[model samples]
Target chain A: MPQLSTFYHTLLRGRAGLLTGAALLLGSLLSGCDLIEFSPNETRTPEAYSDLTRKNLERLRQQPNPSGGDTVRFVFVGDSQRFYEEAEAFTQSVNQQRNVAFVAISGDISDFGLIREMRWVHDRLKKLNVPYLTVIGNHDLVANGREAYQKVYGPLNYSFEYGHTRFVLVDTNGREYGFNGRVPDVPWVQQALASPGPGISRQVVMSHVPPHDLDFDPQLVSPYVQALSTAPRVAFELNGHKHDFSIGQPYENGLTFINSYSFEKRQYVVLTLWGEKEFKLDTVQY
Target chain B: MRRALLLPLLLLASLLPAAAQSAASAATPDTLSLALAAAPAAEPEPAEPAAAVAPTGLTAQPWYRPHHLILQTAAGQGLITAGVGYTTLRGRVDIDVLAGYVPSKYSITPMGIFTAKAAYSPWTLPVAQGRWQLRPFSVGGFVSHTASSGLNNSRDGKYEKGYYWWSSRTRVGGFVGGKVSRVIGRNRYGHPRTLGAYYELGTNDLYLSSIFTNLGGLGVHEILTLGFGVKFDL
Candidate 1:
């Protein structure tokens, strides 16, 4: 009882101590709420960080195309996993570029597929002057990343059209699923590409693993490539995972696959597209 | 960035001396004598002679018998965790085994996390005439394995060995914490029966690797996780 009385007397002595105590309590409470994580693999994220893909797309719709004509210009990058320093510099570099409609990150938003990692990447990318988009990569699909990605970034396969260009992004990290063969969702890709609507002119496919890579599902490669090759007005397929820039027609069917530079590469691609199947690629060093 | 990393260390360093000072002052002979004088009157069941040497001799029970029960939440363990522990090394060290549960709402399926942890408390300060005690600092480490029916295997012969160097199901982490306890009664062994509340700040191996690789990019606080729990001396 005496100790209790003494403790109360000490607290009553100074306003600064009381204020410091109150501030510490408040700070711990706020940070504690976030730090009370169930597991690193937990898919749950705060509302502010969830459904980011949909939110970014919505934001993109509100801004008029920076490049006025029928041309759509965007910064293309990928594999942001664990490259926090690079992400910040990349943002600064992309923000300086003119006529960029948005930034498209092909995949691997997080290295470990952890919710915190995704949030960390978003913390950097959210500073962009233009909203950015991402597709799921093999690393993003690790552990419970598929559900985490779905919660934080919306569907794994989706298409959005802007400035007469239709962008089809899908999940092509098949090895993560043990090469389940159902991934890449070929039917969904075909459907998304089948109808570009009256306003759509050129179609572009984007994903994480390029079909030529061994990580991609070998069984679905034929059908997946055939789906893109036959899609109307399709310009090319863009991918990440390779961590460097390369553009080539690896298939006998004449489909051009363009690999993006990972964030660590200190480089990114700026693509300006106009008319059906016509596009220009420019690399920028951050 | 350097300042940010140094801030937490400075805060922790400042706290240690203040706590030690309070404990040193509270352990004065006057308080000890007063506590000793009041012990027998309040708890007649505890033998006076045995109570005098209880700190070292309290663990006369079987080695396999646990000395405390614990219930905790979060800290990257699970939604709810329950466990038992053995206290030894004059109550400075404790080894615990816990089983944690996370509902399906947080994952593809309900997860059961099993963890074994060990902690060392360098100081225990009795206050309020032995009615309360505070352990201002404790450092510990834990290893946990998560089991879920629906969790995809990171290494189920799906790739060549070392494709993913880290195991998805197993995690090893370390934590620092403090506890405050109130003595309610005396146990059969003439020891103070106490109930304590504690909080821990911790980070896992993966989080450490992320920060180590990107020291300038990630902040130390971003990797931390907090957990709160209660422990009862059995």
Candidate 2:
């Protein structure tokens, strides 16, 4: 007995109510997933030592240093491909040669610095009968990356002297948390270069990101360039970030810098320190 | 009393002769066959009134009839996008805004959007009902836009800050599908309802494309929901 107008109004109201309810439910369901969004870690965690990290570093340090120094030739390579088996094969092949002193991986030891990559790299590097050293790369800074790097590779900015040559490795990834600076810890390199070991005849700096690479931090380049020019024992600088073979000769002051490319040539540089002030660059093919 | 009885008997006797004559004629071979045929024919003629009744089925309506609207949100590579869209038999149109986060300088401040886009579908098909009321297949077409925003940086060495708005994100695509529907209605106080399965493909909404892009490519996917309380004109 309802009037025609009343029936239409009731039907429309019911339809609208149902539609509005559906919209509300859809909105909530969609927005709920959005609420669980991912935010990049803003605060950087200081790389502190841990049991596993310390154990890994000690394992690397424990590898035997050869007794006699008869023209010690170490391979300086960086940015190994992602395949662990390929890298392990390369390491084993290099290990078979008896004259090689030690292997110094410039940086990007692990593409992501994930525990898996670090472990894989470590296990593969263990195949070598010689000692191996690594520097930190940009990819190693995600999540607990620095901690993982220091745990697996040791003090990232530390120096080591082997058979008259002093090698200074530093963290060049900078604070990529979108900080105000251009690059990271330049002063550390300056001090490291200023003080080489007692009988260290040659000094060389190695890092993942090259100072001359287009993707490099401009601010960090000047101070690093200054350190390279002033250091008396400094020979040629070795670097690998460009992923391709490139050489730059920056005539800043009096430093003749040689910026090496990536693992393209299956190659690394062999520096022969010819006593206190002179050295020779021999690009070794592995 | 005797005279009245006699009058009634006289009337009955007079009517009995005519009745007897009609019965005799009906029982004759030729007359009986004709009478039987006439009776059946008369009965069947009354059935003609049924011819005016309307056939019970769905109406021949256009396929563009849309029954729902959808919104999508996607964020990736330091960018976030929010979109609102309307779908109908005619077509669809959507507006989207993108925003980026700047965590270094401040937590709350967004670097703003590097890109923003708005898309409009000029023509759409009523492919939903094609697989249902008609055969099991339908097709449709739509033209759309997909713009990009340029990037900006505040300082030479630091984080970039700027926005780029793209003009031409236009594209065209088609969809083909089948739809099936079922109506549920209780006669008590409400109208009937419809529910069923439907699939559409084409140059779809940008949000769907973005999700598919994030997933690698557009393949098979599902967005299931229940619809009730629909109205129609007879």
Candidate 3:
């Protein structure tokens, strides 16, 4: 009986050793495999995926031969939510165009606002021949979408100037915040519009939720629209949440608001600007 | 707030591995099955008397008694999750229900998920003098409903039908893995109680769809997550 007990103990110890080995391997494998996700909205991304705004800006800034900072032609599009097939077509269409300097998306980068959806859009948009940037959208603010958008695209409200144009990307999705009255950051927009660098000829504001839409905070609409209308060298405001193509002055204050079609529409607009308060809009179908 | 949400999960995790609860349950199972019973290894044969005692006619347990309790992390279910399951079909199939938690960050609120899982294991090898089992392959799937804000299953009346597609609250995922268990002695309820550790590689419907659409770019591993946990007979 003693011998049998000893043999059983030996077997248990051996099995324990094997289990330990397997556990160790599993530990290492967990780290190596990207599949071990903690949550769908989890915020772990590689260096290349994070701080994308800085990366894209760096790419834009490091161009060697400079243009005369005068005529700027760029692709303006929006609401690229979960339209992979359309995104591919959009990219192909944009690449074929001549003299397009970068691209702008109005918002709604992801439908459910999951990190996976943002990454999918980014992965597809990354294929564009020219550098592209986006503003935060209502859909992008869903769940942990605000964080995911900020992490992946940089800031909800940020601005950069290239070729006599100061592109100010603002967060205008007030309804996402239950109309807390602080969104659209009127003060920030006024300031950015107030101070365009020397020789800048135009300013274009872009956001997902347009001021005219009910989603925009009604209380702050006057202040927001006023800032844009009064801003220096204001050309036109671009938006994307409508998923349709519309170009008009919603407030009829001589301030133009251009809404880009969603990727599913298989059409995008190319805006060409040459002088202060002067622009041309062209739509391309993919 | 985050700490408060996770406090219960941490407590459950700490209470799962102790096998003494299982031992005490052999005498009175009512408390063991209902309470957070951290069971100890059931040693069927007395160490010194090895082959001497072969007790007869152990009482059979009610069919509804849980076969095991599971505590797992990741697998896209939660940062920490716990569940109870019943094993059937010659102990090769399991059906479980898990409650999982996810911590909040930024604008996203912390959420809890309810998951129903079923697994089928085709082969189990008995080793260690018939006191242990090694299941090399376990295949299963789960339907999890995320009880979180903003993951809406239906759109408001303002939007047209199919305005926004895809179900946000419900998710279907599948996993494949292996388990190693140690057999304990029979309980008074006439059932073999075993303690096991398992690991699974899993992916959800959305991830799988992404893989299928972008097969050239995405790898099977990119969409998969690992779920490891302890399982014990109740």
Q: Chain A: TM-score in each candidate?
A: 0.89, 0.70, 0.90
Worst 10 residues of 3 chain A by lDDT: A11-20
Candidate 1 per-residue lDDT, tens place, A104-176, comes to: 9999999888889999999899999999999999988777888888898999999899989999999999999
Q: Interface RMSD (Å), each candidate?
A: 7.3, 16.5, 5.4
Among these predictions, the greatest TM-score belongs to 1
| Structural similarity to truth (TM-score) of each candidate | 0.85, 0.44, 0.79
Whichever of 1 and 2 has more lDDT, that candidate is 1
Using DockQ as the measure, name the better of candidate 2 and candidate 3.
Answer: 3
The CAPRI category of model 1 is acceptable
Q: Put down candidate 2 lDDT per residue, A1-286, tens digits, no spaces.
A: 3674465454334432333244334434553331121122111122321233344346545645443542346666777634444465567667766556777777776543333345545656767766677777765654334555655556767776666777787777653334435354777777888866577777877787766654466666777787787886787777766665555576656565555435444666655555654656567565
Quote model 3's TM-score: 0.79
Of the two candidates 1 and 3, the one with more favorable DockQ, higher being better, is 1
Q: What tens-digit string does per-residue lDDT give for candidate 3 at B92-153?
A: 78888787877775225667777789999999888766677889999999988776664433
For model 2, what is the error of residue A186's alpha carbon versus the real structure, in angstroms, after optimal superposition?
Answer: 2.3
Mark the 10 consecutive residues where model 1 chain B has the least summed lDDT: B1-10
User: Between the candidate structures 1 and 3, which one is better when assessed by lDDT?
Assistant: 1
TM-score of 2: 0.44
Error of 2 at B204 (Å): 27
Q: Write the per-residue lDDT of candidate 2 for residues B60-163, one digit (tens) a residue.
A: 12222112212222122122322212223322332222223333321122322222233344533333332112115545443422211221111223323321
DockQ of 2: 0.02
True contacts kept of 3: 0.34
lDDT (Cα, 0-100) at A109 in candidate 1: 94
lDDT of 2 at A15: 30
